[model samples]
Target: MHEVVAVRATIPGMTTTVDPRTVFETSGADLDAARAVFEQAYEASGFLPERTERVFGYRFRTVGDQTMSFRSTRFDARMVGEVDSGDQVSVSWVTDGGGVLDVGRDELGLSPGRPVVFPTGRPYRFELADVRQSVVQLDRTFLERIAAEAYGTEPGTLVFDHTAAPGVEAVRAWNHQVQEASRIVLGNAPVSVLALADTARRTALALLTTFPHRITARQVPLPTGATGRVRSAVEYMHAAAHTPITTTDVAEHVGLSVRGLQQAFQRQIGVAPNALLRGIRLDRVRDELRAGTPTDTTVASVAVRWGFAHLGRFSAAYARRFLEYPRDTLHG
Candidate 1:
């Protein structure tokens, strides 16, 4: 199911009417009219709008097992130019078509799977290139608060880099899952709304933590009435460690910078980042070693399966940590 969320802001006796429709469809001039409506929505959201061209487009909104409206589209590549005077940050994930995004002075290529974020106060440009996107915007203050919580550092100091990092593949997978959940939330699954909202909140928190920063604070705030965001992030990593994992991805999932993420892990787990990752990999290897499976199983296969990128290095590391060669375990 397809879904969109539209929020509206209206001013009496204004030249424009803003209606943010989550899921809706239009065609011909009507499509252009909807684009205009979106432009108004952007303006109402405190963004300065530039000229935008109209193209055929479709949108849908949902709530429970119900969907509202749907339409198909065919148009020359359409574009919308936007600037937020208030300097809000937007965290967005693309569902279709790759594009080049220019945020301030940096230009980055965006593709399907991974999520990207940009600050809105500056001039930015994007060529969607037949792109379909699932996006959400956060107020600058809110983003700062979340970042501060993750880093245990000063707010408004986190700087996001759009480049991919280790475990990026894992992040992409999670992002797609969030997009699907978003679709359900906007489509028609009341049962999913709360879950999706919680997911959205967690995703936002994680993305913030992925921003690059130096360590300054020793302890970050935790979620109230629970171990908090940091614990949730650790659990997420432990649960998904067998999958390709990266510190940045985990940090973003928990809303901390690489340094902050490292600091948190060291404080809570008593080990460094790579150490923990290696331990996780080794633990999985040990489990396989003890399973007593077929004799044809090779140590190299087990190493690769646990994400050892190099067989020789994996063997040496395994011997160093376990005091036994992987081959010895495989043969024994």
Candidate 2:
């Protein structure tokens, strides 16, 4: 696949980078048309099925520079192709539908919420139908540096042995992050360079830790605790309530497995970590509503500011926690 070329201006002071962040979409019954679009977006080349193919939809939105970019693609029909064997690593998550990827004698079945990394320099053939996927593409060199520093695995030997999301907990976290990224990249809001960089780092870290890699076996499992780490986990939740986080992150922060953290919370605090986190967020929202006047703060704004995107759930949770509506607190 060819890198996107920048248009040079003859009038001076118009030279720019290759491809700026943009949303590209197209649809029709043309076979080659779809192939070309996907080829430019994903460095994959192959013929589309010549059967009764109806190209219902295909779209991709890209953000960031060549070092890393987050993209989302929607394929409404079957498309079989192979990627260029290059140094670009794609950590992909299938949000909907399913597909089969065959790479170097290994065949993988893709499903919703599961992330798989198509490592650099591997040419893989894919047969995907009606799939909506988000991909984080980064250079292999960047990943190698991260691997060497954090995982103690040298170049070429830091193999991502598995393509699974580890468990249900990891699936939830993965979906949340991928969907969040999709929203940002696809949305109309301007994405600053720093924001895109943060997104790339977070996505890379999640990809590395969620997928089983060669360093996994070398690292010894930290002992689990139910009592000692519960307070620490609670503190972490309270501190990071405004940010996007998961139970797995809390467990990792406290050197415990998710089950271990849950057991500890149950034993010491009489509630699970997630429940306590929700309560803490609810309290923060309530306090904000109480402190601000109705003209200064709206229930919706306050709720969303604290990462409560679903107004229905936020309202329900607020009522359960405070025995009164959030609006009441704002006006009272």
Candidate 3:
């Protein structure tokens, strides 16, 4: 039997209230019924136990664009299938019990504090015994946008190095962040839109930093010419102008040493990379302020969104470039 509850969940950092459709309890002792229920609830494709008597409990909730779910099962089952993540990334952590997950030629042991990060298109096989877990799902486009703003490029593939052992401190910190995020998603805490966006951005950055990906590697080299290198760097700056990135990050992205990149910029662009980045960020801030409405949007928020942290400096730069105060532009 499954019980559905219509309850409003207060999302932390959201100004508006959201009513989430929740599945509070779902359980069945029969194998086929259990399999059908699981598939309907999670859209999971797999073969479950046919004869063994098992117990299952599931709870699911959604907040804005994200979903949080928990599942507990006390039976031996083989999940030889996949969840259609459909342009979303799913992160699951084992809160209790353990399991074995096999993806292609690799097999991972799922235990407490161990996280599995994967994009939605891959197929996985799992053998579970009395396992309980929590899962968090975020839109792929949202994360990609954040990555482009932060890294100046879109990630190629969201693949985690499951084979690599995470450090103790890193694992602990990641677990803490995940726990807090889960609480906000699952609990009834009133959240504002600004706060939600901030949390999502922080979570995406943390995931990118903690996980290993092909794009994050420093193996790719830029084109074999000064003009090409300078153009590439400039393009990256334009894409990531809204992010708080340093010149060193730009240099590293184009596969050049910091000093080499600086020299190239001087020779080709006649200005430093950091200066160009600042100019682009300033333009972005002006554009946003111009487009934003006076009631909901503020000059400080727009400036901060475009990576301008110091209000005084940001205002001075805006006045010098646009010949008007940012507040005037926003109001106008």
TM-score of each: 0.42, 0.51, 0.52
Q: Compute the lDDT of residue 296 as modeled in candidate 3.
A: 84
Among residues 3 or more apart in sequence or in different chains, the pairs in candidate 3 whose N, CA or C atoms overlap within 3 Å are 12-191, 13-191, 13-192, 14-191, 14-192, 15-192
Number of clashing residue pairs in every model? 25, 1, 6
Query: Which candidate number would show the highest TM-score if scored against the true structure?
Result: 3
Comparison by lDDT, 1 against 2, better one:
2
Highest-scoring model, lDDT? 2
Better of 2 and 3 by lDDT: 2
Model 2 backbone overlap count:
1
Candidate 2 stretches with Cα past 4 Å from truth are 1-23, 51-55, 152-157, 162-165, 180-184, 215-332
lDDT: worst 10-residue window of model 1:
62-71
What lDDT tens digits, residue by residue, belong to model 1 across residues 107-156?
77777766666543234555544556655544444555666776576764
Model 2 pairs whose backbones collide = 226-264
Question: Model 3: how far is 258 from its true place, Å?
Answer: 49
Error (Å) of candidate 3 at residue 214 is 2.4
What is the C-alpha local distance difference test score of candidate 1?
A: 0.53
Model 1: residues >4 Å from true position, as ranges? 1-31, 44-55, 58-76, 85-87, 163-166, 169-173, 176-184, 187-197, 210-332
Tens-digit lDDT string for candidate 3 (53-95): 3444433333444422333344344344444344466666767
Query: Residue 308: error of model 1 in Å?
Result: 62
